[model samples]
Target: MQQYDVYIERQKRKRQRLIRRLVLFSLITLIVLGSMAGYHLQQRAVYAEKVEEYEQLEDTLADLEHEELLLEEEIELLQNEDYILDIARTNYFFSKEGELIFKIPDESPSY
Candidate 1:
């Protein structure tokens, strides 16, 4: 009978040790998973911010391209002799020889 009692006591100790090991492993796994989740969220936020910045830069580039096209058009217009003559005559009061130069005040208020 005493031998049987000793055998039962050893089996109980072994079962308790097994349970403790399982619990410890579960806790470690939980901690690792939690940290991974946090890191993933942080990286996602940074990616979103970068995407927003990239979109803004793209919009600015489009605006600059449009402005460049307008400037090119203006440069082409300025190369025309008719446009240059018009600007010189209107702004600088230039005219052909024997042409009367009239200095009349504008009816509308000048800003």
Candidate 2:
């Protein structure tokens, strides 16, 4: 009876050790999975921020293109000979020799 009692005690110890090992492995697996999930979430956040930045840049480029078109049209107008002489006379107050120049001031923004 004593020998049987000793055998049962040893079996109980073995089962407890096995249970402890399984619990430790389960905890480690959970930690690794959690870490991987956190890393992926961080990556997604950074990607989203980059996409937003690129979208803002795209909008700025579109506005610049519109401004460029207006400037190009203005340049075409300025290429005309009469328009050039008018701008020179009005803005610079320049006149040809012996020509009657009109002095009329206007409220406008300068170039």
Candidate 3:
């Protein structure tokens, strides 16, 4: 009878140990899964911000392309002889040869 009671006590202890080990394993798995979910959520937020930034860059590129077209048109106009003459007359104060020459004196220092 004494041996049987000792055997029963040992079996009960084994069962309790197994239950504790399973509970600990379950707790660890839950923690790992929760942390993974949080990490994925953070990555999604960062990815969304990058997408917005990319869209803004695309818009800026489109605006620059429009400005480039306008500049190209202006360049074509400047290639005309009359447009070149107009710029030289107003900006450089140019006149035809054999015309009257007037010299205006300036008090400011010339560099």
Residue-wise lDDT of candidate 2 within 7-63, one digit each (tens)? 999999999999999999999999999999999999999999999999999999999
Assess each prediction's global lDDT (C-alpha) against the native. 0.97, 0.95, 0.94
lDDT of 1 by residue, 1-111 (tens): 999999999999999999999999999999999999999999999999999999999999999999999999999999999999999999999997899889988899978
TM-score of 2: 0.70
Q: After superposition, how far is residue 111 of candidate 2 from its true place, in Å?
A: 29
Q: Name the weakest run of 10 consecutive residues (lDDT summed) in model 2.
A: 100-109
| Model 3: colliding residue pairs | none
Alpha carbon lDDT at 14, candidate 1: 96
- Each prediction's RMSD over C-alphas, in Å, is 2.7, 5.0, 4.4
Model 2 sits at a Cα RMSD from the real structure of 5.0
Candidate No. with top lDDT: 1
- Among these predictions, the greatest TM-score belongs to 1
Q: What is the lDDT of residue 75 in candidate 1?
A: 99
Could you tell me the TM-score of candidate 3? Answer: 0.69
Candidate 3: deviation at residue 96, Å? Answer: 10
Which runs in model 1 stand beyond 4 Å of their true positions? 108-111
